[model samples]
Target: MKNNWQLYVLILPAVIYFIVFNYFPLYGIQIAFKDYKAASGIAGSAWVGLKHFENFFNAYYFKRLLSNTLLLNVFNLLWSFPIPLILAIFLNQIKSPKRKRFIQTSIYVPYFISTVVLAGMLYIFLSPTSGIFNIMRTSLGMKAVDYMSEAAAFRTIYIISGVWQTAGWGTILYMASLAGVDTSLYEAAEIDGASIWQKIRYIDLPSLVSVAMMVFILDCGKLLSSNTDKALVMQTAGNIPTSDIIGVYVYNVGLGSGQFSYTAAIGLFVNLINFILIMSVNKLSKKVTDVGLF
Candidate 1:
């Protein structure tokens, strides 16, 4: 530790930031067990034990809320996780450096597009009256349909849009990992006249598994959290059941109803679930591949 004193100094600010902003706010978690009042504040709020937790668990919408959150995460993981790995492998294989770099840059542009703008674009592209999808359908002599109102299609739209936005950035991570792989393996494969597919399968894919597992585990840690901004922007009255995730639900309950104590309890609950997910996945990773964040 003493030998790397300068390196430790570099990380001190980030350490302090997490302690001050993240760990310190945890002291207010007690508000979840209390009937918090605005004037009284957290410290002065009367302790009500598990009243808020009980209320949340027994609430009429509890199952629907939990199911929607789980479904969104599950479908998202299934569709979005592998795409970056596939795209990264393709990016890594491109012999022309200029073309590869240009393609990578082009794909990443979508990620920086604001969620509100992306959601608006989706509405425009899927609008029954004048949308591109309906326009194509009209050219085929087919009827236009309201895609945004289709609850069954909501999950697919959300997942595909999310992947389109973030997959390119994720590909960069895997590509970086692939770059560190020993060049001798590829040279040896070339000597054996190995096909590109063979080289990718035997060399590139194996090297990516460790990094991919870490990324997967990190994502699993956030299974209970849905990004509120994106969900809210994409949401409409018609797709309430499909789009209302835990984060959105908490925002509505907390600020919309001013139920501070109840919201605190729900936040704590979500954090606990996230914690369990990360721990469990970490253990499984160690068991299967003998590798993990720890």
Candidate 2:
């Protein structure tokens, strides 16, 4: 008991954080089942049961909102999920430590740029007139197109910019995991006359599986979640259909339109789904690889 005291002390801060940031806010979820009025506050709010939930389920925007959120998540899963693995593998193959550090530093710079600044830069670069992209199009005798206003381009821009900003930062964890892989495995593979590709395929990839699965599970849990600020900053009326993800939709309902109860209900539902996804993925991971967050 005396020896375990330090471990409890180490966990005290996280326990406090969850109490303050997570458990306390659970009381507010009741607002979803009430006709909440800011003047009356949460305690005095009139209970309406599942009225708000029903409203959201039957709302005209339900299908579009759900479709947009799921599609964006799918796109992220398909495209963004594997990038760090590939980057980490390629970066690990570089023999020069100095050159590797330089490349990593350069790649990581984009992640530190504020979302507002990054979105502004994207807008300027993709603008129809006086933008470099359009200028190049015109130079090539093609018509200059306004990419920011185009629905088809919204997902492309969001995914590509997201990859540019986060891929390097993501690689850091995978690279660390790769570094911890036993060098003896590689030596054994080489002694067995395994080619470099075979060494990577049989040895390096297996070592990466646990880290990769953990990351994938985390990503899946956030499938319907996004940063409202980034989405709003990048959104335009013309591209709203493509860019209006769950976070932005919630922001619009609660803060923008004052549909507080409805937004609460929707947000609660989204969080529940996320929770289920995390649990399911964790269980599956345990079954498949004998590794899980639990």
| Best candidate (score: lDDT) | 1
List the global CA lDDT of all models.
0.93, 0.89
Q: How close is candidate 1 to the true structure, as a TM-score?
A: 0.97
Q: Candidate 2, clashing residue pairs?
A: none
Cα RMSDs of all predictions? 1.3, 1.6
Model 2 earns a TM-score of 0.95
- After superposition, the stretches of candidate 2 with alpha carbons farther than 4 Å from their true spots are 4-7
The 10-residue segment of model 1 with minimum total lDDT is 145-154
Model 1, 1-294: lDDT tens per residue? 999999999999999999999999989999999999989988898999999999999999899989999989988998789999999999989999999999999999999999999999999999999999999999999999888988777889999999999999889889999999999999999999999999999999999999999999999998888878998888888888788887888889899999989999999999999999999999999999987999
Q: After superposition, how far is residue 239 of candidate 2 from its true place, in Å?
A: 0.8
Expressed as tens digits, the lDDT of each residue in 159-212 for candidate 2 is 889999999999988999989988898888878999878877987788899899
lDDT of 2: 0.89
**TM-scores for the candidates:** 0.97, 0.95
Model 2: lDDT of residue 10: 94
